[model samples]
Target: MNTNRTPNPPRGDGHAHGFLGERAELVSALLALTVYLTGLILELTGNGGPATLPLFVAAYVFGGFFTLREALLTVRRGRFQVDFLMLIAAAGAAAIGKWEEGAVLLVLFSLGHALEGYAMGRARRSIEALGELAPRSALVLRAATPVEVPVEELVVGDTVLVRPHTRVPADGFVASGTGSLDQSAITGESIPVDKQPVADRAAALADPAAVDAGSRVFAGTVNGAGALDVVVTRLARDNTLARVVRMVQEAEERTSPTQRFTDRFQKVFVPGVLALVAVLLGIGALTGEPFADTFYRAMAVLVAASPCALAIATPAAVLSAVGRAARGGVLVKGGAPLEEFGRLRTIAFDKTGTLTEGRPRLTEAEAADGVGPQELLRTALAVQRLSDHPLAQAVVRDAPALLGAAPARSAEPAAVNLRAVIGRGVTAELDGEEVHIGSLAYADSLAGPPVPAALRERTRQLAESGRTTMLVRRGERYLGTLGLMDAPRPDAADTVAELRGLGVTRMVMLSGDDQRVADEVGRAVGMDEVRGGLMPQDKVTEVARLRAAERTAMIGDGVNDAPAMAGATVGVAMGAAGSAVALETADIALMSDDLRRLPFITGLSRRAGRIIRQNLWLSLGIVAVLVPATVMGMGIGPAVLVHEGSTLIVVANALRLLRYPDVREARARR
Candidate 1:
């Protein structure tokens, strides 16, 4: 049960405000520019003494205010930051009686800072948008009537009435009635899913989303034309929408490899710049240069050495790419995973629920010589009703059509005694006759002659076709075998092909199913390697082996897969919209069950990594070129222009990541 409602604040903290909040720095920069222009006109006209000096002074004050605060903060913390260097440069210009030049430098520097803040704000907007999706209040049913309440007040097992076109206020299962839902907030699907009654517990266990009208409804999704009575399954704080918001907020704060590298570089780089400036000043003074000229040249060094662009290079691109990924239905948990995912050399996928849909369906059935297929199905369905195993539900689903009516519990024969053997099968006395259904080993242990060799061969054939087979028996006779298949996702092959196209060096399928079944699924999905009959820990061992050789990513969705997923370099949870555990444990969560997004995410991450490298080089290249020029006698004003211009260019380069198109279109272009 969850208790909290509001998600933690996102990295940027989007708040409603007048233009001041969004553009304070921009406004200040504009004012400084205006004052500088006025001072220039007065100085050029030569009546500049009283009017021009005050205008330049005012311009410096307006523009330097923001920079001064940052510089002061850095100084108080005993740190050398780019802002401190800019402050020293501005003061050096004024000390040399170049007040107008100082004012222009401050104006450009402040403008660049303002623009960077605005660009970062755009990146943070993606997480903030999620905060606005779920409604704050919902109508709850009480005493056979409806009453409105804060979403936080709603608890598990409560019934909530959702009117047409209203956003669902909590995570729950549809209890009654039916409706289509705009589930984009959860699954990122553009179309609505039609709600129907859910199946029994076994079916639901096989695939949590398979329940009929009991289809899971997530908070924040809009209800369609018909009314839906949803039974609250999770409290307000535990809803899928809330978790999405929380994860996004958390992800933004984690540093990427590039960001960490930049931080390390700056620690040495900032102090080194200060030392270089000091050396220049000492050498100029000792060489008998005029104090004004010496100090002016040192100030130029300060302006040229500030690494504003270098400082923001990685964060700008990283933030933009993370936000873009979220909008495309993939939640990259943090900068670490995003960077790691881009370096994937191999991707290991789980078979059931990943490469294939989790739901099993009956594919083939054979009967003993005397019994028809329908009679065998009826007995299997009746026996399965007492259990909810995935294979049992598959048989139950097929029995209704054969029986020409829904299977009724009352119609099932009363069993005098019942027993279920885990991992083997079940035994029961129905209509005073002994009955058994389970794996062939279990059937062989019962009071029956050996199963026909032809029947055994048929079951093996089904397994080769990627199906699970069960043996059925009645009294002393062998009934037959039922083959169940959990088919691969429609897009599984395409996803594999696209990943290979995206430079995925290897693809492996790891499954708990039989080896032959795993091989069939691997072949169908074009997997490069296949390993089967793995227990949960075996999967983890395989993931570890792959990671030891090269970077590896494991994609899975189940409680058992959690450990294996956690062991991989990057863990991707498929169909995360339906599983809370997947949402919490996965390094990356795919909101939709769509496998196609895997390739898309790979491409997006690779593109982001490339852009970060580009930004770093561009920023460093600018410093490399401009610093030497400034030391060789470039003027303070021109150095300021080049330095601040490079800052803007770095920001512009990072903003290109925000143009990340739809995943499908991106893949198509690739």
Candidate 2:
């Protein structure tokens, strides 16, 4: 969730004047302390009288003058804030001749407010740290000379030079350099991305460009070990960093379910407290108690049962929990999303780019005919070297190293004749000899002869086991078979086990891949069910179906997963490799692309929810006990003490949710 607050200019005339004002507040606090001490000394010396009353009054005035002023302003503006309640409680204490109680109430309430302010300030500072990661200026190249300029001065189509170790100034395409880029600041991937000039061209040609020289890069990402000249494609304010800031702000603005319930409860709760105070006063007056005693009792009841503790409990817990989540690389969209996580019974995950590594890998290669194994390997590598598909690249990567020098690099294979049969293989001429690589169907169609029974059976076995088998042939002769598969990520099994331990009972793998691939990966990762060959909308329908059974979370990292992610009870996005739609749509973003964080965040959310419930109960229980006792002739001093103590307990309990040591350690262990 976005924790960013709107930027406000510092509220000081100047640095010196600001310091002076802070000193003045300090002086006021010290003066109030002295007055409180003087009153206590007078009481201890057996001289408690009108003089002591004046000292107590002086303590209240000095400590709470600003609070009272603000309270009055809010009242004039037709708003009733918590400060107004404190002011009323303090004034009532004095009116009841409880000078010590009034002094204590003012001093303690002021201190609590100050402490809350300090905590909020610290939280704001942590959020601001994210904004500071982006550089303020860009080094633009003009006439072959580099000129440093403010980032705001950059525009679309302008070329800027980024040096090693500096944050990229804007979202842009690299013009003429290759390097590694660290996108952890934006996507939370730990590995630095290797970029090349050729890769950049291919990426740019793709609707969404790849990371390479001349490929677009975002602000706040770091360039590693190389200098790059980039053509700015997006203004500074419209870059990925800015979008993150915007998303966070929007998330924060969206009210959580808990907040809505609390707000509705308060609308009735405040009036109920007021009615109870009136009833107590009426009963006391009818009993013929002194007017002063009845008034004191009534006001004490109001102070004892204000429900302020309840007001602060849930929000404080949510704020603290969200802050801790941010530090741990999870962005919970809002308190509602965090609360929903604890209720999840089933989690549906996208297979490609989520449960399994999105990339395909070469698993096995076997010669089918008398053709030598080395010849088949060489032929496969030569043909695949000209293609950029992930499967083709995987095949080339798996080829054995040659004896000495690297194979000659070619822009494209040069051959007298070439043919590509989709879903099968390709045939081409190399040094005037016929060469081919592809599937069995394409090979048999070309040969028009009896198919080899052994090769067909092997291909069937591989296909049934979720492997893509490619047949290589030359002219009318069969060569060999190549096995390719989209393997499960190494960490997938451990992450699934962790989620099970965290109470996720039903885990389903959903993918657009074939059922064979889905079943294979699902079994490896311990998923309870597998649904494959699903389009984006189909995934959404499945998520909705799961939600009917119980609360469901959808975890994914691609455009196809966007709708399903949004439809789940709590959407989790793998920040790294996640499409823009998925990142923006998911309720929570796992910044590090590590599924292990899923269980850790789930544990944290459950713990936070429990803490919130405990705080709510504690605050209500305290009021239930204290209000009745105060009505039964308890003194104002004791009642105020109990009320203030309960508030402190609630605040302290709420703050404990911010202790994230265990959450961090959990992720580390995973």
Candidate 3:
């Protein structure tokens, strides 16, 4: 439901543009390699001299095209870069009459850049493919006749006809049909979900995207066997897929803390390597060693010390992990949260809708001694159905089927002259008798300061067990009591157990529900702490307190949870499919709404961290070994081999995350 308005990506041709740029770089690198090899063959076969020198020069020109371009631009900006250092080393090799070695260096460097670009393109393509999941054109209903139009032309209120086997064109509601949807692409749901028309006119009016989750459908899901008339609630650019793509793009642009540290390291590392190379040349001249051998050794040291592998290590791993998470329906906002997720040890949950199913169910219904149970139930339904309160919805759904229908002698019963008594209950007239349905206190405040001992006892028992009970009265006579409970989610306990397994031992539930009900749910979910009966501001205070003690994460899916989420180190939103507030506010959004994804994302973050540390050490370790060996006696050819070889090895290691398995599966393997 996130509707943050980023400019929509261009339709139809964006992926092609990205593909072509990578292909061009690769072709240039291959051409340089071919030239360098041909020059080598001529020299070894005794066809070498001044005449053949031009061939090696051409090889250097082709090989250094991208490196020289970037190096020149970086120099103009008064900045030092790895590319600039490589260009200087290659030119130094040529000045020392080692033209073949200079050509070899440029060819390998350009080819490494090309091969890495091709590897990184896989991550970029995964994001670009998301924009194309929904069809380009939608069969929009135009005055009862279906006409195909570009998806971008779709606006709110347009009725789109989704035919079987086609992708849904925009996020909308089922206005006139029922069917099943394959939402595996959007929600990672393994089974096709049964969908039907669900009407909530008021919710759709206030925020079309905030409608009930069961009733909503998103773009890019494959339709099942029935035709559906979907009323578009969001514009094309504000759909679920669009928001995900925008967030991923933003994530790649933002640097992580590790990337920032590496950047600072490189600023000093690049300049210092250049100064060391210069000092080596000056010493060789002072000692009167052979100029060619000393100069060649100094150039080799510069190539080895350039920090090429170090520069790409962290970013490569971060990008691969971000792309992998997006494919599994987890949207990480940026690299900062990706890193923070792995380090979180204290996670707080909001109860009402988060830990539980969010829907209240009727568990018990009873009547007084003189009251007919059917009569009591019918009368209660008439009064409760008209109530515009949040708690009344579930009872209204449960009551109609149990009572069947009104008698032939009377019209459909409805409460007239209705008035809500705010927090206490509701008051209205049913067939001219004053009827009320409210808490036990509200009933006691009326009907003689108390109902009956039996009714009070039942109410007390239900409340003690964490079930909410309401009393019904008809003027001066008491009717009956109704008990309801918001049960905990089936997977809540297992998810908490897995989180504990992942090293997050402190799991707390912060709820606005009654203390007793919250405690029951917290225990059911296997949480270590329970803080219930908290207001929105109180939840924020608790989150701030938790943050003071440890790195905290707050997870919820409502507008009220926003403040507490902002206070925590990381704010995670569950079921963010259609809520703009959830999407914009939470640092990470589980697009699928499955609690299992929580552990998956956390595991993925931890795995990415391990890979990043490995990369940094491997790259730094190579630079450590190569710089000293080249200074002592290593030749230019061997130095270039080991240095570029380490760069390739680091890139290959980071790409392993693109295939990281689910946490449960990984544990099974181990």
Candidate 4:
């Protein structure tokens, strides 16, 4: 969101013009003024006089010369566009001695085209701003000193230091430091992630091993309070941000079916109108009507039947909607993607960072006899202090009131017999007593007795509620239990309901977490289906399956979710906590990580699309009404006025999409 990136000013020397090209607005305004003044002078003189004809010719040249040239070139290339129709209609009017009418037509059409171009340019600029999200430079570690270098200069195996408050330069892992990282830019989760060194090998896991470090972190994520020495893995060109830009560019290149259909319709429609006008003139001549009257009427019919309104309708609305979405912090890749959003009947969301907070929190605690909950919490906090596990950290954070001024140091080795059971918990001995902390089943087995009904019920309830339950014991004696939960995001339920209201019929939750956890979250957020315990590849497969069934939208915030996001009909990324891969892979990015905005955007897109269709129909209807009326000996003047006026009305109606009411409401809620 760096809105203040100074625009490159147009150069006066004209060696090369910048994007603005020296205030196109001023040039257009001057042209409009000239046309208006000339029209006024012609009206003050006699309307059908030779003196007014030259002024009309000048106005026509000034207003539509470029359009005419372009249209001719396109026609020669076998691409008969809507612009060609406008040029032909203006030329036909001039040939029939309706010079004033021709000039007015050119002026109106040129103004509409210029306005559409400006709207499209604004949309393109907004999309380009998204390309600026990644930082250009990175701090690389050479020998023992850190050096600032362009991100592209860094390569695989090169050590880079990412300090607190700085974006990670490229995808890599933590080499020798421990700290929290706010990966919201990549993952869309609001919470920060804690990083630790991989502990499987020694030499292979050197204090600064390149391979392991290169496999963990991602670009565009923020390093927190701790410093990390990372090895660059991906090249700048292959980074997530670059991939997203490429995808959007590709999408832009593909034309929508609607646009193609309109083109076909215009080709046939224009020729048919000309034939009808010719037949009408032939009938008038056969019936012995005035020849001049019949010819003028036929020209009117030709002018009126040109599909000017239909041509402007769709593109204008698309430009407006895209602009509105960008201003609201959603980066919709293009008009087609925006249109697809309106058709989304089913939406599948990733669990860790989609429906839930994606961060662990303490949910339950129990105490042993003689050892109060506070005492047990203090010991657990002391032991977990050295670990970077999110669950352990959550427990430590929840019991801060129980911790004394002289906090237990995790750096201090626990009493003898300290051991961590994989996928269970930790165990240690303190003060000559053997302490066991693990799953309820593990503790019950060690205790060698039927578990108490109360403890069993408590454990089952916690487990079913999607909590990670840990049992604390003293040797063969059961002491207490702890429960941790990754709670649902506060707005998750409301967002799901709103999406449903917006015509999203089916919603699914997809996650890498366990089935029970995913199911619990799914129910909480009103998901219609739940798929869990999936790897990155599995997510891609699931999305493919969903696509086979119906058009699907995948919402996620993890590096693991990238493939699935790309595979879905429409992909939405949580901008705040999403991984760089997810952000760059998604078709649309919710920049602020507010899920509520999803429904609002979908609604706006639907409304915009409807308005576009209405404008098209209205434009066609005007042509349909005017063409028949003019061909039956009606005057050319009124027909020309109606045609130009209808085009202006359609263009203005389409532009109304730029100010969607739902966008304002969504922002107000924020």
Supply the TM-score for candidate 3.
0.89
lDDT of 3 by residue, 1-670 (tens): 2222212111111111246656876787788888788878877898866656787788788888877877776677677888888888899999988888898888888788777767767766776677779889999989899999999999998989999888999998887688999886777665677888767544664577556666689999999998888889888988988888788878876777888888889889888998898899899999999989888988999999988888888878888898888877788887788888888899999997788888897767788878877877787778877875656876777776666674542466777887887788888898788988889888877745368899899888889888888898887788888888998888889999988888897999998888998888888889999998899999999999999999999999846798999999999998887777778888888887677788889888988899889999999999999999999988777887888888888889989988977755345346
lDDT of each: 0.80, 0.71, 0.81, 0.67
Deviation from native of the Cα of residue 5 in model 4, angstroms: 18
State the local distance difference test value for candidate 2: 0.71
Worst 10 residues of 4 by lDDT: 8-17
Residue 205 of model 1 has an lDDT of 36
lDDT of 1: 0.80
- Residue 456 lDDT in candidate 2: 83
Q: Which ten residues in a row have the lowest lDDT in candidate 1?
A: 3-12
Residue 479 in candidate 1, Cα distance off native in Å: 5.5
lDDT of 4 at 342: 75
Model 2 per-residue lDDT tens digits across residues 1-670:
2333432111111111123334555466567778898999989999887788889889898878756766676567665555666677678768777778778767765554444444444544454565667889889987879899998999876778889888888877676788988875665444576655444543553444344322557788899989998777667776766766565544545556766776677667766777787887788789998877887777777767766667667766776676666656577777789888977779999998778777788887877867777766777777776666677788887765531244565633454455666767676776666777666666667645545888888888888888888887655666778888888989899888888888889999998889998898899899999998998889999999999989999998735677888888888888532245655777888865577678768888988888878878887898889888878877656765676576667667767766755543454447
TM-score winner among the candidates? 3
Put down candidate 4 lDDT per residue, 377-397, tens digits, no spaces.
656665566456777788768
Colliding residue pairs in candidate 1: 196-212, 196-213, 197-212, 197-213, 198-211, 198-212, 198-213, 199-212
Evaluated against the true structure, the overall lDDT of model 3 is 0.81
In model 3, the runs with Cα more than 4 Å from the true position are 1-17, 45-52, 198-206, 366-379, 399-422, 426-436, 448-455, 472-480, 663-670
- Which candidate tops lDDT? 3
